[model samples]
Target: MELLQALQDRRSIRKYKDTPVGREAVEHLLEAARLAPSWKNQQCWRFLVVTDAAKREKILAGFGDDNPGKKGIAAAPVTIVVCADPAESGIENGIHYYVADTAMALEHLCLAATEMGLGTCWMGLFNEDLIRKGLGIPPTFRIVGITPLGYPDQDPKPRPRKQLNEIAYFEKWGEN
Candidate 1:
């Protein structure tokens, strides 16, 4: 699928079918993430693919009951934990590049999933410490975000977005 179509089609999928995601599709998504650019090619991103029901339950423990993504995490056939090794990337101007690097990779994975007719919801706002302990993640790696992967059960309409003029400028800020 074209990049723009994928971008337009991608949604924060919250409902998934009981169907299973194929291994090849999962690998394809991971490959898309692995090929993403990184700070000085440090490749700080790491993905932990969780498919076991019990393990998914363990990860779900990190999320509060109010989190809408919790149900998706429980329903999807796969949950990819996006992680990053901060030391592997650079930092400048009080900004951490590792987070940016990992986020781009996760976006790539999400787009790929969208192109493949799969669904994903980029989710944060969970208890990182609980997730780290439950998933047995190493101390050096930070859990940046996670997404549930499977066939979408619902056809949600596109959400509203700000106009380009409102968000972007020609050459200067506030000069749209």
Candidate 2:
């Protein structure tokens, strides 16, 4: 698919079918993430692919009761846990680069998933501690986001976006 079409059409899918996703497809998605640009090529991202039913349930438990993505978490064939070693990305001469590098990689993964005819929802409003413990993630690694992946079951309408002029400015901060 063309890049612009993929970017415009990708939605936060909250419903998924029962079909299984192939391992090759999963690898392809990760490969896209791997190619994402990072701070000084630090490439601090790490991904955990959770396919086990019991573990998926555990991850779902981390979501809040009111989270709309709760069902998607439990039903999707794969839940990718995107993590980052913060120290590696931003620690240039003892400075923290924060989450910029990790965020870039995740955006790439999301776009790639969209192009591969798969659905994805980037989940952040969840219990981080529970996820870290449940996934046996190292204490030093930061859990940036979790994306539920599978074949979409719903065709949601696109949400509105602000006009370029409304949010963009020219050379000056307030000048369009």
Candidate 3:
């Protein structure tokens, strides 16, 4: 699909089919993230692909009681936990840069997933500590986001977006 088309069409899919997703497809999606630009090419992002049933349940527990993505986490064929090493990416002389760099990589992953006929949701409202422990992630790495991957069961209409004029500014902060 065209880049613009994918950008416009991709939505946060919460419902998924029971059909299984292949390893190659997952690899392809991760490859997109692997190639994403990072600060000084530090490549601080790390992905954990969770497929085990028991483990997936544990990860699901991290989500809040009312989170819409809760079922997506449990039912999707796979869930990828995105992480970042603070020592890498945007770090400069003791400052941290991983947050911005890792975020870019995650965006790349989501866009690639959309282009590949897969569904994804950027899950931020979750228990970080539970996730780290559930996935056996080291304490030094930060849990950036989680995304469930599968064939979408529902085709949701696009959610409302702010007008470009409301968000965009010219050379100056308030300039149109």
Candidate 4:
């Protein structure tokens, strides 16, 4: 599939089929993520794939009842937890790069999943501390996000996006 087309077609899949995702496909998606660029090649990102029912249950408990992604997490055949180590990245101009580095890797994984006829929903807004303890992630690492992976049960239309003119500039700010 074309890259931009996959980007356009990607959706936050909330419902999933009961069919399990193959390990090969998961590894392929992770390989795409592994290729993402990072500051000084730190590669601070670490992905935790939760397939065991027991582990999934523990991770699910970390997500609050109000988190909209909870349903998706519960339905997916697998959940990938995105974590990062700040010490592996650096700060520049008062902006920490670890977050950006990790986010890029996650997006790469999501896009790859989209291209593979799979589904993913960026699941943030969870209890970080609880998730860390439940997942047995080191305290030094931050839970950047989580994503459910599986064959989508629902095909959602694309959400609204800011036009290029509104969000991009050719030469100057507010100049197209």
Task: Write candidate 3's Cα lDDT for 42-115 as tens digits.
Answer: 89999999888998988988998799988887779999999998877665787677877777888888899899
**Top-lDDT structure, candidate number:** 1
- Could you tell me which 10 consecutive residues in candidate 3 have the lowest summed lDDT? 87-96
RMSD value for candidate 1: 0.8
RMSD of each: 0.8, 1.9, 1.8, 0.9
The list of candidate 2 runs beyond 4 A from truth reads 91-98
**Residue 128 local lDDT, model 4:** 87
Instruction: Give per-model TM-scores.
Output: 0.98, 0.94, 0.94, 0.97
Cα deviation of 43 in candidate 4 (Å)? Answer: 0.6
Model 1 accuracy (lDDT, Cα)? 0.95
Superposition error at 51 for model 3 (Å): 0.9
**lDDT tens digits by residue: candidate 4, 1-176:** 99999988999999998799989999999999999999999999999999998888888888888888798889899999999999999999999999999999999999999999999999888888988998799999999989999999999988999898999998888899
Question: Which runs in model 4 stand beyond 4 Å of their true positions?
Answer: none
Which candidate tops TM-score? 1
Native-to-model Cα distance after best TM-score fit, residue 122 in candidate 4, in Å: 0.7
Pairs in steric clash, model 3: 90-97
Clashes of each: 0, 1, 1, 0
What is the alpha-carbon RMSD of candidate 2 to the true structure?
Answer: 1.9
Tell me the lDDT of model 4 at 65. 89
**lDDT comparing candidate 4 with the true structure:** 0.93
